[model samples]
Target: MSEPALTKRGRPGYDQRAILEVAVAAFNEFGYDATSMGVLATRLGLSKSAIYHHFSSKEELLEQALDEALDGLEGVLLEQSAQVGPVIDRLAAVLRGAVEVLTSRLPYVTLLLRVRGNTDVERAALARRRAFDRSVSALVVEARDEGSLRGDIDPRIVTRLLFGMVNSIVEWYRPEGPEDAGQLASDVLAVALDGLRVSTRSTGLDRLDHR
Candidate 1:
């Protein structure tokens, strides 16, 4: 038999996982709406038909990509590390897990973050993201009720602030850059949960005398 045909990129076979990875990166670099099947194929050195063979459409590819990112995050909630600890510690553990997932799957997470819910897949992804936020917020509420976390701030606001700080990592994090995931996770937990106080003692309104 003749040698197997090669794609324009001169490859004999395509790896589905690798293809999805390239697609995710392209979706991040160029807006998903602006990136087309043909453009993705060209970027991957494959024919449009080759890509079609694996993904029915760009929407399917996007769904798969976001799924990878969302799954990693959702998986964190199920970890024993996050499930059995004190409420405050559980919340901190989850935050660290989120950082690890984001750092490990940077492109997919980055793409998931940028999606604007313009399509059904994107909207579904957004719903899942909101669910995650609510779950984390529940932890904050529990910690406040347990008196381990400050109760003055609304739990929802605490969740927003904590994730707002963690999520901001997507904007500047580089897998090849100086920081590693372990260190980043520690630093994030330190700043978000521990704060900058010289001591962990109460310093805000809780410290004031009501008299």
Candidate 2:
């Protein structure tokens, strides 16, 4: 395919990254099913041919966007801290890394969370998501076995509640807002890990019941 025309600044008018960014935004704003190449071209002020120059189809675009989100989450599992530390510490690293990914790629992650398996691409993304969840659940189970986490709660429930808190940030988090990614990750860990950690001393509830 012929290269896209250059702008006055001598940059390709719309590189694949730029097109993908616009496409992802549109996909997030309008459901992916509702978004078409014509809509993306109109948003880019270019011909449909220009979009095709970079991506083969809307499905290709969706696949790339979902990969952007899924790859980041999967990478967290491969991090040194996640792979090498104590199980509870590894779980904490995974949680903190996920918050980083979500905040850094808010649009992509938001689209990922909204996926419902309508297309083959969506189903593939869902499979990867399930795999990621299973990895997390395994870590939770390991931590509980190590006596770092409470034994009563099911590991699967812990995985869901932990990510539920992380995933919900998409609804309200803003890049321009006061809390940066670090603060947000810290706050999530503080609340989630503090409650989740096995207590060394009597709890407030234990004291109240005793009184």
Candidate 3:
């Protein structure tokens, strides 16, 4: 059979997914304003026209990438809130799910990281990001009210700090090839809930673990 029009190592026709994957990498490494469609083509070893066929422009690709990362949080927010057991448990579910999103959608999450509220697109992305943050903060408030979270820390400040740590993972954290994403997520949740701040009495998770 004849080889396709464009393929990896020049074997077959272009795969839109492969091309977009390259584009996402480029955008993540270089800011959206700095990355060009031509650079994306070079990275994938495909023609610029091939990328254009899949996405109209670099901004469109950015929009698409951010959508994938941000959308994952929506379902998490809905699912966690519906659990009636405890607020801290719900918040743990959120942070853990967020870490899963971090690993599963690395490229998209990286792109989301680069947005700085400079452009309209970036600003809109920031708004969406904050909305998800507010959702998580709401859970933190509930947790504090239920006596799970320490009353000394302001729920709003704690929520911001928690997400700040979670978001910073994109900067240097990479998923280990042999590590389980689920287990990693659980560990992160446990760390946040239990905290580096050790308690003399039974920990907040005592209730969760006994149930």
Give the winner by lDDT: 2
Task: Determine which window of 10 residues in candidate 3 has minimal summed lDDT.
Answer: 1-10
What is candidate 1's lDDT per residue for 1-211, written digit by digit as tens?
Answer: 1234555667685677778888888889888988999999998777898888889999999999999999999999999988996988898889999999999999989998888899889899999999999999999989888889988898888889888888899999998899988999999988887777766455445645665
Candidate 2 vs candidate 3: the TM-score winner is 2
Each prediction's TM-score versus the true structure: 0.89, 0.88, 0.82
* Runs with alpha carbons beyond 4 Å of true place in candidate 1: 1-11, 200-211
Whole-structure CA lDDT of model 3: 0.77
Clashing pairs in 2: none
TM-score preference between candidates 1 and 3, better one: 1
Better of 1 and 2 by lDDT: 2
Q: So what's the TM-score on candidate 2?
A: 0.88
lDDT of 2 by residue, 42-124 (tens): 99888898789889999999999999999999999999999997899999999999999999999999999999999899999
The global C-alpha lDDT for each of the candidates, from Candidate 1 onward, is 0.88, 0.92, 0.77
Q: Candidate 1: how many backbone clashes?
A: 0
**Candidate numbers, best lDDT first, in rank order:** 2, 1, 3
Please count the clashing residue pairs in each candidate, in the order shown.
0, 0, 2
